[model samples]
Target: MDALKEGWFSEINDLWPGIAVSLEVTKVLHREKSQFQDILVIDTKAHGKALVLDGIIQCTEHDEFSYQEMISFLPLCSHPNPKNVLIVGGGDGGVAREVVKHPDVEKVIQVEIDPAVMEVARTHLPFMAASLDDPKLTVNIGDGFEFMKKHRGEFDVIITDSSDPVGPAECLFQESYFALMKAALKPNGIICSQAGTAWANLDHVTKTLNHCRTVYPVTAYGIAAVPTYPTGQIGFVLGSLDPTTNFREPIKIFTEEELDKMKMKYYNDKIHRGAFTLPRFVEKALTSSHEIPQESRKEL
Candidate 1:
């Protein structure tokens, strides 16, 4: 963990104006305005190399595994057989890195709009970008929505490793994106996406879950703790094509030897179940018998 002698990179979340997280910056590896947003790769004091997009911290070497492993494995393990997977907006390659670890997965198609993000990640974040060259992975540089529209009932599992609901990623959190993902999933397939934070954006979690229910009969929510993210936690929305799919339990169990072989750092069968246990307020908001009042509904 190398610390910078003088400079620092501060991530200020406009949505949550009260708090800001900063890392001691050692050196800037890359900085550029790509086709979408501002991309930056920096070496930090304690978290090692980190990726920042639009002045927000996306992932760091220290705790990125928690987010990558949880998001990728949660939906894949919940399905009976996840062979062909589609990842939307994981340009850094962390999600792809985790998706290829499942032995049952035969192919992975990653769609990212920005090629610059992948190029920077490959050079600065090798731990996550290492799997971009795997034979099982097929990288496509294009809009994820347009790509999914052409492929229907094709993917067994679809994971959206997108940034928060802002800038280029704003559309990714809308109902239309989930609708497209629903149409692209196999009959018994499952889809998962990074759905903001429960503590900071409960409205985001509630509305996203509500939108998902419109497309997929089986919909649930999960959370993971990451130090670099806002509120030190992130939430995921999961939807299943089959109404009876229980997301809390793993359909395909992994043995200890298999888990060790995968070298999973943060995700396991027990952790999968525990991730869905939301706080009282979040549970009430997401599963309320009555509609959320007009005053209670704040725009996400």
Candidate 2:
């Protein structure tokens, strides 16, 4: 790919044009073109092992916990009893790792579109992939959208840990996808999906939240600091079937000792409440009556 040059791997994409994030590559562990996308695993100089998909940085070993933990717990903790959880995408297994750690979560079913991404993560990024072996998690290799269509009103919580809305993951960001997730959830179920960076893709983020609003009565957006991601930040779109659901306050509060036991690095009760608090600009953009251009809207 054109992203690698002079021992540095740069992430340059049309989604965030004119800007890129580069990491120094110490060694190339594995690189190949999978049926779904280009999968690359490399040993970085400082950030540790990283997984790259279709020339975009999926996660680096350094700060992946921030995104993984927030995405997993923000919704899991919001629900009173999230016993059964369904994970859509997240081929790297990071989301699975965190999802299985929840005390209330008993069973996890992960549906990933690309098995090649999971294989590369298992071979090169075991820190995140090792959790895929958890007995509580049943891994399925298939299309998440089709999988959700077959199962209805089953899962208590469904987390969509997808990449940017492009390539194989494009369908996961649509309003239809949110509707499907709504159909696949049990009563009082909550769903969270990866929303793009507001700093770089505010309009796209607003569009995603708007799509969720059409499906679920309660919808909110939250963010976490992921240095490797675009703009050093990433956001998540959360929706709950219950109107009383508060995305800002988690129902299950973890004690410090419990957090330590779970090895949580970035997520806690305080951080959970703060994640939904957006900057003034983002709040205005999401709440204001400003109409998005026709071209900016995603075709349903």
Candidate 3:
């Protein structure tokens, strides 16, 4: 039974083998949690219900906000100033917390497809999840693709914290989805999306980066370390209308000088720039235009 558990966990998720809020066989709800694309929502510790897809946690209702914050803030901080922001995916209300951190941000809209995930998060991860209740935030639980269609050229920043590109989050990685997101941003707006890991999913990251360049003037890739994410390494795809105009200078939000106080453990000037550094293998894969093989990947 232990070995089978290891195999199930190893095959489907990037999280550490044992790091979780809680783990109990959920027999209640009289549901097996299999109808939701093999994704099971298990009640966990402070973070809330964890979405375990195919026996692996695709996302959790709790502690996901931390991942969202570092993802959103670094890019959000990169932009000299960001006002309106749009979040695609992230039904857990994590991204919304980080966006409101900056005082300059006046409006934020988060579009999520699953209502159940959002409800679990709201009831569980409260401190960071509190932003979901903010009047400044307009929470829409539905298709992100449709929402982008109506709000053209509106947002200053767009953050995509999507799940793996296999099931529900697949469309979030398509060329058309990016095109619509590009259209929904202001002229000088910036775009950033979780491109998975350079170590495990180089093909996915490279594909996203290349596709983004076709629509936006500038496309760059960066990475950060989140212990729970796949390979404990994750990358981001950033696109800007004009890369030159999208520069950052330390301001009231903690400029290069006051950044000492910020003391963000993960983000720094060097780390920010280094996240774009691709390994020889990835660089080769992107240049050669070959789909990275399944065997090369480290599973989930």
Best by TM-score: 2
lDDT of 1 by residue, 195-233 (tens): 988788888888888787777767888999999998999
Residue-level lDDT of model 3, residues 1-300, one tens digit each, is: 023352122233433334332344332121243324444454533434555544545554434544665578756766666889898877666678767766678899999877766665566445446778887799887789899999999998999978777678788887887799889988868888888777766767778876776677656666666655557666777777755643233233556654445333345555555665667887676656634443432110
Order the candidates by lDDT, highest first.
2, 1, 3
Per-residue lDDT of 1-300 in model 2, one digit per residue for the tens?
Answer: 335578899999999988889999888999999999998888899899988898899999999999999999999999999999999999899999999999989999999989998888888889999999999999999999899999999999999999888998998999999999999999989999999999999889999988887777678889899988889999999999887898888899989999999999999999999998889999988876225444433211
Residue 174, candidate 3: Cα error in Å is 0.9
Q: Which residue pairs in candidate 2 collide?
A: none
TM-score of predicted structure 2: 0.95
Q: What TM-score, over all chains together, does every model reach?
A: 0.94, 0.95, 0.76
Best by lDDT: 2
RMSD of each: 4.2, 3.9, 6.8
- Which ranges of candidate 3 are over 4 A from the true structure? 1-3, 6-56, 59-66, 245-265, 268-270, 287-300
lDDT (CA) for every model shown?
A: 0.88, 0.90, 0.65
Cα lDDT of candidate 3 equals 0.65
Clashing pairs in model 1, backbone N/Cα/C closer than 3 A: none
Q: At residue 72, give the lDDT of candidate 2.
A: 97
